[model samples]
Target: MDGIEDGAQPKKKKGMVMTIAAIAIVSVVGAGGGWFLGGMLAPEPLSSDEARVLEEAKATIKAREAAEAAHEAAPAGGEHGDAKKDDKDGLPKASTEANGVLQLDPITTNLSYPTENWIRLELALLFQGKPDVAMAEQIHDDVAAYLRTVSLQQIEGPRGFQYLRDDIQERVDLRSEGRVTNVIFRTFVVQ
Candidate 1:
């Protein structure tokens, strides 16, 4: 009986030791699994300020894209060709006496006073049909010569220039035998 009891004691001790080893193995596996999961699920760390700035940058980019799309989709007449075409067609076409506007290059003249300055004067003639090319060249030459004769003092002020323009129109009308009715200035430069 004594021998049996001692043997049973040894068996009980071995069972307890096995149970402890199993529990330890389970704890180690659980810890390793938790570490792996943490690595997979963890988010990148960012300061609050940095996060706010990133959000604002994203918003700004989206807003600019939206604005650009809107601008492209809508018609902007001021910057487009349709507006210019409309302006040209909207003007009342000149009558049989004056069919359309004739654009002419300005005659540039050098002034000999105070400073070495230059003046440019443009002219637009209203006439019926396309005038003969030779006649137009002759008219241009005659007008340029006439402009060369004008004194600097006579065309110094706005009123003086206006009168000069009117006088030039009248002279052109006379030269063309009433065929040219009006003159419009396309560009004027005094520098």
Candidate 2:
């Protein structure tokens, strides 16, 4: 029994030494492989020429941004380079000619039939000569009142809408006394 116990102790010591040796060899191999891969994947340093080019690119971007900012700050006008093109109100000048057709504010009113349904309309008046803002307003009011009397059935289809336009134009002619040439319908929406 004594001999058998001594033999078992030496066997355990030998197994432990073998495990330690195996672990050390594997660690050394792993470290060498990692070092080799890292060297191969390392980036090359940038040259002086490449660094100068990068600086130039950044400067160009900054210059372009400054130019765009200046352009946006400038007032709107007739032409891009014309400094005197901007109007007194700083708003973009209208492209319309003298005594040209003038657009008025939109008119909203409920239809006579289907009183719940509301209609919106935008109008432009073609003047025979100089546009009178006062007369234009009066015509706009008359048109709004006239639209209120129109039933949904009266302005249902294209034909009905044509009738409405003609009626409105005729009314404008009578009110303007040959001053207004035509009544142009810009937009119409029903809700």
Candidate 3:
């Protein structure tokens, strides 16, 4: 019986070694296959045209940065310097009136529900004929007032944004009495 048990122990050890060897071989093959597939499926190098466009974009960005730096370094006392100074955010100020379009001053107000959250909107109204400054001011005030009543949830998604746009358009039409043909949303930000 003792001899039989000792012989059985060697067979058990051999079986365990075979199982480990099989696992190792499978793991190595799997890793090699994965590496080969990854190389095969890798994205191709950018074409010459794509590379040129990328370089051009980089150059344009660098030029813009240098121009901005130069502008910043220059004295602020030119004809447009007052306008630049007036712009608190350093961006180019939109003209209030140009042709039949009249841009309203940016409207910033807190949300009704969450008072901490605020909305900033810049809108341009396109008039059918001559732009009415009085009507435009009234519309701007109305829009600002309307926005104050809005909640974060009211303008959360694309559909909500569309609804807000529609509401503003309708309000502008009512306030302008059909004088305002379109309301171009220049900027809309909520924070």
Better of 1 and 3 by lDDT: 3
Ranking of all candidate structures by their lDDT, best first: 3, 2, 1
The CA lDDT at 1 in model 3 is 100
Cα RMSDs, all models: 29.4, 23.8, 12.8
Candidate 2 per-residue C-alpha lDDT over 3-105 given as tens digits, one digit per residue, 9 for 90 to 100: 9999999999999999999999999999999999998866455599977875786687579668757876876667663653322224332433264677777
Q: Where is model 1 more than 4 Å wrong at Cα?
A: 1-98, 111-115
- Identify the runs in model 2 with alpha carbons over 4 angstroms from their true place: 1-94, 97-99
Clashing pairs in 3: none
lDDT of candidate 1?
0.68
Models ranked on TM-score: 3, 2, 1
Model 1 residue 162 CA deviation in Å: 1.8
**Model 3: what TM-score?**
0.52
lDDT of 3: 0.83
Best by lDDT: 3
Local accuracy of candidate 3 as per-residue lDDT tens digits, 87-177:
3345443443435777787787889966756788989899987788899899999999999899989999999999999999999989988
lDDT of each: 0.68, 0.80, 0.83
